[model samples]
Target: MPDPLGPLSTGILAEAERRWDLLTAADPSLRRAVDLQRGLIGRSVQLFETIRTTGVRAWPFNLDVGRLRSKLERGVPLLRDESWTLPVGPLTDALLDFCRMLEVSGAGASAAHISQAIDSKRLDAGSLLNASLARADCDIRDGAIQLGLAPDLLWLTAELAVSPYAYFLQRSLAASLPPDVLSTWDRGDCPFCGSWPALAERLVDRRVLRCSLCAAAWPAHSGCIYCHEHGDAFSSAAIDRARPERLLETCGACGGYLKALVSDRPLDFPLAAVEDLATGDLDAAAAARGFRRPALRKLLSAQTPRPS
Candidate 1:
């Protein structure tokens, strides 16, 4: 019999099928958007795997940012057209809002500045928001704010970080990952640079954490992912212990929170990244109190992946 714990694991696929049915029934649009996002996220996961297993470390997880940015700049036009109406759905609407911000922010920004913003992770959040509002001919300053989002740049930038287009950009850059990288890797988190994770996941029985850049995933230690604090020595708790399906893995020492999903059996799905995106609300709730993914958000930070 095949190792059901592996990527092609049957348990994982069954879980995915079950959850997918529920998701599709609840919100077909969400399922569609997730399907699209999965491709991007999956490519990222593979890239990080390559970096770790290959031992062929290069600049920025062996990525060439300049070349990557140039491609994005050139491809933006192709990504849109007169008849290419933006997708409309819950997540798509959110994505539209984010794209508006990018368009607005990039309008007055020099190409060099735009590139710098992406690189420095200091892209103007306000400008992006304003621009997004402007494109829609709506006044964001007066728009109703909900779900902790303000009519400001910060909200817009956050949207961009998780945007589908950004995922596409990251995936495209990830193609540079060597085929043998995973064989050399010991863990995830942008195998090349060793940066803190954008998110952590529990896929069936494996614990995987991924880097915000270079899109890597590797096995995570049981203790605090950031400080390597392990066992009962470090404080940890789940939001609902009885409901194993949902968990909030928080480390009081470093103030990091990563969600976990417990299942009766293991899974075959790409559980780590999938779970992260699926449990976005948990991330939001954690961030509400100032707890975050415990990683730097600037482009310079992307230059070198940090240690978890």
Candidate 2:
């Protein structure tokens, strides 16, 4: 499908326009999120393009497959950490440039300014990079802490740190892993990272869960990927303007909502960041029905946070 997320794609642009129409037709309470999605999509395009640029491969940390297998078999999360050091100077600079794009797009002007102060005087790259790392680390540790951080800045650092591993995994591991390797993990969370599905989809005979982080998709556990509650009692009905391939699936047990893309064909890999934005109306519809994404609850339970 020529990378369904490409912002320049006429198909995707048309899809974006349609989604916006759905959002506008719905209630007004979700305007901020829908508008935020509009901004987020552009930034996601910037990041994805950056990731796919020639010779921009991420680091290849050795994986302990035996351990991963054991954990998967036990329904335990694989211990994935973003500890490998990266070129902070370049990453920070790129992040700032992205924030500038955000400002130009009218997304997060104040947050961009807050992040821009690191290089306000156009100082040496080392100093600015160091400052950026410190700020990024602060949010990774404690999201509640207020240190004049922009949400965009936090997201940028997270992408810079995790996307490499995710990209590397998508390249070397995801496709090559044995199908039986996942026999034991049929729970609500990602067996690889324990992250919940930001978006999900049901194919002809089975469903898939796409991780909010890592952008990895795996077979789902039948119903309620958030709480694993089995039933047809979800608030995920398709409505006006919703395509047959997409809808919102909100679980009543956990008050968790997810965007599901239902299709008759095989499920495709999701452009997680862009898909999240693209499903803004599904998010609004789910929220309007009083269901949340469960990211906050999932965040509070785990000390470490990944993209939601």
Give the candidate number with the greatest lDDT.
Answer: 2
Query: Listing every candidate in turn, what is its Cα RMSD in Å to the true structure after a full C-alpha superposition?
Result: 13.6, 6.4
- lDDT by residue for model 1 (129-156), tens: 2233222212332331321223444333
- Residue-level lDDT of model 2, residues 208-263, one tens digit each, is 88776555667887667767777766556665553767777778888887788875
Query: Local error of candidate 1 at 55, Å?
Result: 26
Distance from true location, Cα of 10 in model 1, Å:
16
lDDT (Cα) of model 2 = 0.55
Best by TM-score: 2
Question: lDDT value for candidate 1?
Answer: 0.43
Worst 10 residues of 2 by lDDT: 299-308
> Cα lDDT for residue 282, model 1?
71
